[model samples]
Target: MRREIKYSDNYLIKQLPKATAYVNRDLSVAHISDSWLNNFNFSSKNVKKNNILKAFPTLTTKWKQDIDYAFLGFKNTTKTDKYFDSNIDECWLEWTILPWFDEEENVIGSIIQVADVTENFLLKQKLEKLEILIAVKSEIAKIGSWEYNAVNDKLHWSDMTKIIHEVADNFVSTIENALNFYKPGKNQRRITEYLDQSLKNGATWNDKFQIITAKGKEIWVIATGKPLFEDEKFIGIIGTIQDITEDVLAQQKIKESENLLRTLINHLPLNVFVKDLDSKKILVNQSECDYLNLTSEEIIGKNDFDLYDDETAQIIRGEDLKILNTLEPILGKETIITLKDGQKNNFLTSKIPLFNEDNDVVCLMGFSMDITPIKQKEEQLKLLINISAIQNKKLLNFAHIVSHNLRSHTANFSMLLGFLIKEADEEEREKLLEMLIDASDNLLETIDNLNEVLEINTNPVQEKKNIHANTEIGAVLKSLKLLIKNKRTHITNQITEDIYIKGVPTYVNNILTSIISNAIQFGQDISENKIEISANKIKGYTIITIKDNGIGINLEKNKDKIFGMYNTFHELEKTRGVSLYISKHQIEAMNGKFIINSKVGKGTTFKIYFNEND
Candidate 1:
């Protein structure tokens, strides 16, 4: 027989590790474990023979009723019972109530076993909350889990997975049916390969592809699987499936948009380029590469300095930096560029700063249009306009001369002849004849001047040669040496030997002679009369300036008619305005300009602009 050992109920109860107590039918505490006293913060001497409910004042009527059921020969237990001690601290308790029997086998009281299970109960509650949270997150993300058991040929889908497949809750799915959900052809074939690989070699797979749900709706899904193994034996595969239809479609649209933009940029006729903050080229369209006579590979990542001369590069880089700093756009700025082939071109360029989502300038975008053809056309139009203006002025001058000068001369001749006819005395008749003769000579001179003006207006200068400015001035001065000496004028020719201009030599000489002659003729009667000639180059023009200290007219009064034919401001009888008018027309015909500056009692300065020699 097994060694029989017996111990008193109190001894066994006291020896128990759990918080235990034995109570009588009257709900009195008969025995209490050391753990019970320690758990309840009660001393053994204070609660050994006391009523259970009285000892544990926190025990409510519900506890008494449970004990009553045990007294009636019923066994009752509470897995989680809430209790609060005198300190108002909450805990979870487990209580077991069983009927106790005496030697007669009749029920006496109940044996109550109590345990403080707050830690385990709280941990179980936390696990339940976590499961609920995970379920909520999975539903929101359109993600679901799945498992396949190879041995049993069984498949399991989470509720979310079923929902993603657009199936009812009661629907059943096998591995084959689940594979069928993938769209036919490439998607299905790819998924089948992944599954077979995982099953054979215990591999893992992650793929995003299209699928057809049970509702016959086509959608995109990202599926992932990892082979499951137990003791080196391949059991099955567990994986996740996500409904990524919206995300995939959005990505496709974005890709299409990018491609469309690229195509449009490449096909555009305008040069387009993008630069980073460092002023390095990051992007360039086909037109930009063509404009620079470079390939995209050569141009990309390069700054202006790498492709252009130092001066040109500095200018371009400066503009880019300004745009970047100011976040302002430069629009329709006309620029001229000289290419490698010695060809010059014009462009209308615009640059704008590109911004990020934060509204800060991150880079810059530029557009340049080849405006060379347009610029050429504009130059031609300007030439035509100048020609038209010259022609119009010439016509107006001719009409005025005919209407006023010619008519005046004819009227004078008619008057003089009528006077001669009316006169009877031989002396008077002879005087009238002399007057008519003088009038005829005047008429001849006027006609000659008019013809000269008309010739200069109608003939456009075609052949022009480079004439040294100093040499031409010397020639004019030599021709006017006698006139200058007679006037006691001091003349200075400051034109350098290297200064040259493009014009007909004869016209250049004539223009200088006219201006110098006027200086000599209009000077005050003084031995100190002075005239100075100087020439210099400015931009594309050679400017010849003639300054003279002479009896200048009041330009405020005579400016409009200063160059008019036969309009003289001085009282000198030999002063004819034809010289200056002819000089002005000659200069214009040679594509030159004449400017005059004068003040009464001061001096006159004449500036003639001629195209500088190549």
Candidate 2:
């Protein structure tokens, strides 16, 4: 295959279609291809005998020297013209200069071929810039490329891979060493399993696992790989690996915080709930669910509309909406719920609007405490207040009666006794003495009433005994026999003899005697002094009803004051309101209740109940 061209090959060179030309050792144009002359805009007949540099004035000085070197038997000497055109800025050209020799191996002339390569050169520049951009992006993303050769069992990693592994640049890598960098337990097993499966089924893998670096730092990473194949035969694998420790750690922390929040709220005793603006329950604690007689699964995601009557639901919704509109807290608001058992329960609750980062009212947070027992106690306290008011008013009235009535009676006694001592006439002295004696007796009566009021107030609890109600009423009637006979009062006792009540025997006797005597004394235009007393067992208590045909009280105006101390609504001088007042206290102290009903000019009825055993 070794050969050389002689001067006779000038015809062959000139016959080529390229922009080719030949020059003698003198550098004069000796031959030119017809295609070459046409391409360069030159006529072969006029260009044939000119020296190479003289024909192309744009040629540099070095061109002639390079042609002379070619003429010294150098073949295929190459060069390029980067700024080949006089009018174009991006013009470029390539030249291949070959030596034409004689049969004796002496240089005869040189052949020159020219081509324009401007387009290809521009394309090469663009490709080099794109590759640099890709490499920079991979480094910034912590992405590293890897490849494995099945035939030679070789593993090759990019520079980025070595950097991620925290190893020296000169570190030599192998399959075994790379696998060792992965965590020794589950991580290593996962990789081996994925690799084997991918090799068997030509499958692709993209998974996250942990790895230990050369510096022994533990980190999370994501590996993505696809099985590599050539000519439909399995060859190796190639893929990318990325460091993703920060992302995984953040996700783990978020999960832990959510779990902690759930645990704390679940353990609280107060009924707590959170609702969105739509009034649907977003979160409910165990206490809230229990208060509603439901489980969290049933209560959450539901609103009042689902759990209550329309009227109740509307009321609750209005409260929630107010909180949302005002973005304020509502505290110590009492709410009543009628339970399924038809018993009403009271709850004291607090509601506050919850806001988002943007300062928008997004939810409502509420706390509720069951306060039914407290409300009951509150009612009891109110009753006690009314009773105390009654007692204080009675005490004030008793003080007034004592001051006015006792002072008047005592002053009369002093004046009457003084007159008796000074009077000389026997009849006048005797009359004044009688007056003094009557005044003294009235003073004693007032003192006794005041003493009884004081005694009743000082001792709230009294000793009691199980006594037959009929026996007590009978004894009271017998003691008042002389007055009843004089007044012609007819008392009818219809009580069962065995009906018993636990009470102070003296109080029971006094209460019965005073009531019966009043009935007889207050009788108005009656054909006979009529009074009826009866007793029976009813509703876990013994009831005693005393009925009479008498001039009854004007209860519409005087019922409130009927038992007030020293009050007298009638013209009857024997009526002192202190008796009924004392009777009420004695009955209450014995755990009994007394009720009275009366009508003006008609009749009166008194009902008393004592606990069955009392």
Candidate 3:
């Protein structure tokens, strides 16, 4: 549109508000509005071909910088808009200049528009002052403020707000910047959605969320905001930012403490459970789950009736109800439960009522300890006490026998010696002296036997060491080789070389020697007398067997008394029955055990059991 630009025909431009003008590239005035003439008190001659700096000399270097930037071709288009006072005084006008161009893309002139925004500018300045005041107050109170302008796509956060967010001093605030400050995962998503929703529905919100600072420090902040509205149209939002990091962390610590308490309850070894007052389901620990043989999901919502039979359930429910109703703590109550395996186990339980905020019982918390082992130990102790009483009784009988037998021999010897001292015949005196010598030998033998028993009892118990049964057996056989040769007895060793047993060497050797010697002496009349020793491992225990093709006891007549002291099956001249008794006791003391299997004509098999190496 090639049209002539004229200043005389534009009457409205003369009266138009603000300083309006048209200037050529050379700063020659093409036209001037009456508002500009009035503000600057200028005529056509003064403004025409005038330097822009000369017109606004008070602008200092700012005006010169704008002229240089526009004239040096550094930029094809330029706008220098700033607030300045007019000659009328106290009147601020924002002068905006736009460089104009011709059709051939030549810079010909410029359009200058000036607006009197003094009132709007002052109001904004007041608002900025209020914002700064709020920031100062909030900083002192540990609070900050933010505003989002959706229409302008701008964000404004107070200085204190930026500081609270742990951002740099020069950081430009934006919604993206705010969102980036929040920690990832739930907190970020939640806050982003909350802001979006609040903007959409114009809803007010006050929320706390977690964030990571620029220093990678975790912080908690409380954000409170309301929707921004202009003429009932939603614009964006404005809000306060608070650094509630310390308070939030303290609350988290309390929550963690509560969780830790619950974790402790779950991990307790005892069978722990809690029953809800209104609900039939009971929460139970892992121990309780295993006891019931039910999965956590299976038994979590069911009552006693679902887990047990009617009768059993009633028994439990009644007691639980009593504890709940009475609000009394019941502890260490013994109860018997029949397990799914058809085995009964005893439990020591404690039941207490759990109260709600109103002090009303809302649940029953129960703890049960499996006391089966304790009960078994009590029974074992009672049996051991009886056994100890019997042992004492036997010791008393032993003492009486020793006293009576020794006393009789001593009295007879003393009487005979007294007679011998007065005897006149030498033959009679010699007979009395021989009798005293024999009595002395008997007393010595008795004392020796007593000493052996005492030594066995006084020996300190020690842990069984791994010893080769073959080596010990061989040593025993070697010691008794002379006896074997004299009797022409054959010995057979069939024990596995690698099958060792844990035992004391002395006790094990004594047992082997005693049994083997007995067998050899009893087998004197057998045409082909043989003693066999064998060992094998069974059921985590080592089993050793010694069988002899010698005289066997009539089990029908002497089964119970075969291993008893002084109770001999056959009248073998050296039958003390002490060997078998001592061997049995010794084997048991070492944690190994013994059993004798015999038949009247068939021979006896002595089996020894030793536990395997741990």
**Candidate 3 structure, TM-score to reference:** 0.46
Tens-digit lDDT track of model 3 for 465-540: 8888888888999999987876678988998779786887777888888888877877747557888888788788
Put down candidate 1 lDDT per residue, 1-614, tens digits, no spaces.
11222467568878899888777666666677888888879888778666677754566676778888888898885646778776887887788878877766678777788887889989989999999998998988899999999899999999999999999999888998999999999999999999988988887999998989889999999999999889999888899999999899899999999999989999999999999988899999999888888999999999877777666778888998888877789999998766545466788999999889998899999999999999889999999998799688779878988789889998999998888888999999998989888889988999898888888877767688998777777788888889888889998888778888798887888888898899888888776899898888888888999999898888889988988888899999688789988888888777688888998788899899986542
Ranking by TM-score: 1, 2, 3
Candidate 2 or 1, higher lDDT = 1
Which residue segments of model 3 deviate by more than 4 Å?
A: 1-272, 276-346, 350-394, 397-401, 415-423, 611-614
Q: Candidate 3: worst 10 consecutive residues by lDDT? A: 72-81
Give candidate 1 misplaced runs (Cα > 4 Å).
Answer: 1-10, 55-59, 196-206, 227-235, 250-398, 420-441, 467-501, 512-562, 569-575, 593-610
Residue-pair clashes, model 1: 0
Error of 3 at 135 (Å): 42
Against the reference, the lDDT scores of all candidates come to 0.85, 0.80, 0.76
Index of the highest-lDDT prediction: 1
